[model samples]
Target chain A: MTKRAGRERAGRFLAEGAQAVREALRYGQVYEVFVTEIAAARNSELVDEARAADVPVSTVTDRAADGLSETVTPQGIVAVCELLDVSLDEALAEPKLVAVLVGVSDPGNAGTVTRVADAAGASAVIFAGDTVDPHNGKCVRASTGSVFHLPLARSRNITAVFDACRKAGLRLVAADGHAKTDLTRVDLSQPTAWVFGSEAHGLDPEVLDAVDDVVNVPIFGKAESLNLATAAAVCLYAGHLR
Target chain B: MTKRAGRERAGRFLAEGAQAVREALRYGQVYEVFVTEIAAARNSELVDEARAADVPVSTVTDRAADGLSETVTPQGIVAVCELLDVSLDEALAEPKLVAVLVGVSDPGNAGTVTRVADAAGASAVIFAGDTVDPHNGKCVRASTGSVFHLPLARSRNITAVFDACRKAGLRLVAADGHAKTDLTRVDLSQPTAWVFGSEAHGLDPEVLDAVDDVVNVPIFGKAESLNLATAAAVCLYAGHLR
Candidate 1:
């Protein structure tokens, strides 16, 4: 079953939809792929590419596809891509602008932030201890296939990441709803690292203490908080503008 | 059932989540509320406030709550609130700045635009002919309840909205990915309406043809397109700064 192959294997991760699988192929990360038999005649281009590239391909029924696809609207093509291995020691070596995601369990939000990091030219994005897996299919899709584009690393040892950032001489800016300073005023051009927490709760107090600065986006309405992806885009764009 | 009440009934739309239901009462919108008996006892503040406000309240089982909640994460509260009815004729009477959502189906995206509209201090937000219902629970929560604070109106006929803008000496600028002019250079200070379309498919060709001018955000990356909410926020923030 796809569920068994997708989750049980530590070396393998599933990617759903055409854009995601196409991106995996583009990035040379595909280990194996599956396309539901129903799409054999319809998705000729992908089938042709998979055949020409000599990537292992399989076909299954829609019922199997249902168990395989992460999204409600499946695009028929699903891929098993190699899990990327990244080390904090190496990421700190050339750090200019590093980003941290804390307790952000939503894979889509995590993926969009990674894409933003790539777009804004950040040095790296680290998924802190409690954040979602950066390689999840929804995140891969939201990044518009950006999962293969940048220096994004996941870390279970978040304290070590903070220590590494300090050693790298980067400013630690935590995005908070209660912070005093305006994010726009902070010098984003400086060697900086941004820390963001989950949507339900902002940064945990312990993690919040590890960062050097806390900043906020000035809100002028009744909305409780900005969507995490939107806020990430804003901060990343601010850096780009800088 | 909330499903049966879909978009047509205005006086009472389904307000899901404890947070949203609380906001509705705080904003004085709870005409009636229906929660599972457990839900009422779990969050008594909302139930108590409904009673103090002389609004009707009822209790049902968890299964009944499941039938009523649009979102999966229903925080034990579902409210029926009075809808705001702002007219284009009323809004464009003396326009300064405006935004229009053209056939945007995502309630969350629609809500962000509403919040940004208020944050950017736009005179109003116009939902063109076939947009998602503004009162959707996710939409309301995403707006952070800004939908209550913003001057938003759904137009039955959109051409009349444009005519009203013209009568008020307002300019209509359509945001296009392939537009010749850079949005950063455009004079957003004028009495204007910035228009955005659906995420997957853009504006209907007929709607695109009627706008006075087109503007594009400069792109420096390999991304196929920006998410609709991020694009809207970027443009609206620019207008907010202007």
Candidate 2:
């Protein structure tokens, strides 16, 4: 399940650590949970909850738990869960605030944005155009189980995603550094989908052209620009607060 | 320079990669630059800038470059720079907006908050209590050169730091999850110092009691809490927008 190919083939991924395992049991398609003796002792309530849910909980050796974890210091618990991504239509249905990631290769950044989008009450997170898989181990860990709290989708065709967002009555606003409009000046009270690109190279020219508005998060200090996740938090929360 | 002792002993640390090296040259007290032949060729303008600054740019073997870098894929440009931290008095001098990190052990989280604070035009970033060193290699890399763009301070005594902020005529506001006040309701127009704690265990009880105000970033979704950097970004930018 560590490899994307393996996960796709099995239609499952491993959610490691206690928090992830618990959230998987609560809000995700958790197939089975493997826990070390110590982890079972520490998370007895979680194990009981899993058992109550009719999800099988197996106590494995520490070595087996280590094999299933990606972190150096394994939390001694892991869960096999069905991939959680929904279809684009399902994710964006009646969307008011959405976050779209285009060509974001960093798993940590992608996951952090997903978590931020969830915290801000965004309707969905769409991974578009070469973005990292949300189910990747590190991405899942970084999300701290928010991956189970919201709808997520992946689309190779970013243009079609933009069209669908428009069809859902969302104004596509690209968060670009070079844009003339300031983020604060934008009227975020309307249903809006905030489009963000990779931190290295921002939105492609064509993608920027497809957006309804391009706004820059104001940078008042000497820092060149905000990272993808930070910018996403501000943009989504701006819409939420409005 | 990877170890805290080594950096403190030499009174210097390394700025790795092209962006960090460039920013170090532009805004920091750069002692020297080590570059691989390929990196020099790729960053010719940066090399020229170093030369124009009368800084020695030494070309070294890939093996030597690898030895100097913390990253697996070395960008092959590293700059030795003087430590950038200042005294709390200096950092908080006439402050309008400031960020304080208390007991944040994760270098990546600390660095991300530093970058966010910089982008939000915070007056300074003060690492207090048991926080990770701002000079840590991963922290510097995660900061993406913003460490060079702002004033930073470190103090083992978090209480003194808070007192200093109050002494400097700024309100000390702690970003806690269980706070009574919502972040949107805070009067951010006043000069404020936003205090943030580690994601795992939040602000200490006495620390929370000491703050003038405690506010929570509204979580409209099912997420248990926002990560430290995400909360800091929203808090700092709220002050910036005000």
Candidate 3:
């Protein structure tokens, strides 16, 4: 399940670390859990919980756990979980706030944004265009198990995703650094879907034009712009406040 | 310098990539710039700007640039620049807003918070307690040049730092997830210093008790909590809106 192809073929991914494994078990899609003796002892409650759920638990050597982990230091627990993403229609049903990532290739940024969206109570997160897979091990680890907390969707056709959101009564707004409209001026009390672009280059012109509005996060200091995840957090939290 | 001790003894740090090197040059403390031939061609204006400023520019092999970088893929440009930090008194002098990190060990989180604080127009960022050095290679890279744009101060004694903020007429507010006071209720319009803790363990009880007010960023979703940087961004940007 290390490679995207392998995960897609098997419809499963590895959730590393105690926090992720525990969340996976709660989501009720865990197939099996591999834990080292030390980890099993450290997370006795979690092991018991997995056993109660009838999920198979296996003890492995530290070396085996290390081989299964993507981090420099293995957390000694790993869970095999079924893919959690749903269709756009299902995810956007009655949505109030959504976060859309377009051409965001970095797994860490993708996962961080997902975690932020979840914290802000966003209804769903859509990985549009060439965005990284949420099931990627690094992305899963970065999310700290948020990948199991909410509805997620992946679509190659961003336009169709936007259509689906609009059909569900969401106003499409792109967060652009150079946009003339400031984020504070936008009426976020209404249902909205925020679109974020890659860290390297912002939203494509066509995508920006397709949105109902484009708002910029004001930069009050000398820094050029906000990081992608930082911008997403600020924007999502703003909507949450409303 | 890859090591913190070496950087401290020499009073110099390496700023890697075009954005960081450009910012270092603009800040007017660059001693030398080393760039690979390809990077120089790609960033000709940056090279010319360095030469015009009377700073030495050396063309190096890709291997040499790789040695100086902390990333998997080297951007092929590195600048040796003076350490940029000030005394706590100097940083807090006539401050209206500040971001304080206590016991934050992740260099990337530290740098990202610094960038977020900078974008929010914070007066300064203080690294209190046993925090990662702002001059660390990953921290610098993650900051993307914001380190040079704002005043920074580091101190081992977190109590003294809190006292300094209070003496400077700034209210000390810690971002605690479990605090009773919601972030929305805080009067951020006043001069305030926002305190944050490590990702693994939150603020110590003593630290929380010392703050003038402890506020929580309300998590409206199923997420257990927000990431360190995400919480910081939301808190800082909320203050920015005021």
Candidate 4:
């Protein structure tokens, strides 16, 4: 369950915490729920909801729960849910807004971006080209259950994804702080896929060239740039608000 | 050096990584710089800048550098600088845009909000009433050197801080997602101090009451709310873009 290969082989992943597990039960293919006795006693609401949904509830010892938790302070709720990831074609099939994380390895940033994409009413989230697996436990936790609610795809072949987007009539806009065009000036009303890169190295040159244009989130202060997830949120929301 | 009390008593904190150390040397009161022998050899530009500034540059072993690092992957550069924190009065004085972080305990969020405030052309940043210390090492690192570039203040008494902001002729706008007024509709041309709260419980009711108005960043999608740092950045940049 800890290894990516293990989760992949099992065709399932763990969704931890009350909120995320709750969301999985509500909108996702949740198969099993694990709860500590204390948690079962304290969080009757979540346990009841799970039982009402016909999901099996297994009681685990506190020690067992501790072993399964990823955080320093465990929330004592976990769900084994079916893998919900889709293909790039399914993600970008009918997109007004698409959030593409290009080589964003940090699970927190990737998950937060997925949540932001969902909040922005994006059609799909594509983790294209060397991005972290969307099913990673930390990434799933960070998505705050949005991972269960959206079509997420990961592909190493970024070029093909860009070609598909172009063929689908979606403009490709890379979020580069060094770009000449400011975010405020970008016409986000167009069907567009916003691309963001890693915290260490930004977008690759070929990836930049594959896009229609690059846009910079306007920096008014001395800070160099926004965090990838925040920048993605700002860009995607700009399109949504448009 | 690792303990908060030690950092405060010494009136200095470590700024880690190339970018943070470089920024500490530029706009901060950098008293000393530490670089691993390998870092000194590899990062000649930063070493030369430190030497040019007449700051004592001590070469440490790789092991010693690891002790100074707060991140999982150490960047091999650290700066010990005089505490750059200012008084709340100093932060609010003559300020067109000021960002106030209330009860934001996470160093990453506090540091990021400070950087965002600086990027938004804010005159100052106030970490008020149970907020993380601006000089905390992780906060300093997350700021990417904006910690040294702007006026930053820590105050436990938020009430007086709000009074001072009002007296300074700055509107106190709390960025509450549940507020009726939309962020886009807010008049950002006026001098404003944007207030944000912790990741868990948002702003205290009293804190919200003290504000001139509460403005919500419009959410077009299903995600409940923005991260504190991201929400602060969006609000600050909105004022900047205006």
Q: Candidates 3 and 4: which is better by DockQ?
A: 3
lDDT for position A177 in model 1 = 77
Off by over 4 Å in 4: A61-76, A240-242, B1-9, B35-39, B42-44, B59-77, B240-242
Of candidates 4 and 1, the better by DockQ? 4
Lowest lDDT block of 10, candidate 3 chain A: A233-242
Query: Candidate 3, which segments miss by more than 4 Å at Cα?
Result: A36-38, A60-76, B35-42, B58-76
Per-residue lDDT tens digits for candidate 3, residues B36-124, read 99999999999999999999999999999989888899999999999898999999987978999999999998998999899999999
Supply the TM-score of chain A against the true chain A for every candidate structure: 0.88, 0.96, 0.96, 0.95
- Over A51-90, each residue of candidate 2 has an lDDT whose tens digit, in order, gives 9999999999999888888889999999999999999999
**What is the C-alpha lDDT profile of model 1 across B2-87, one tens digit per residue?**
54265465456777877777777787467788888878888898799889988899887788778877777666578877775477
CAPRI-style docking class of model 4 based on DockQ: acceptable
What's the DockQ of model 2?
Answer: 0.64
| Pairs in clash, predicted candidate 3 | none
Q: What DockQ class does candidate 2 belong to? A: medium
Pitting candidate 1 against candidate 3, the one with the higher DockQ is 3
Measured against the true two-chain complex, the DockQ scores of the candidates, in the order shown, are: 0.37, 0.64, 0.67, 0.47
Model 2 has fnat of 0.77
Candidate 4 chain B lDDT trough over 10 residues, lowest sum: B233-242
Task: Write down the TM-score of every candidate.
Answer: 0.87, 0.91, 0.92, 0.91
Candidate with the greatest DockQ versus the true structure? 3
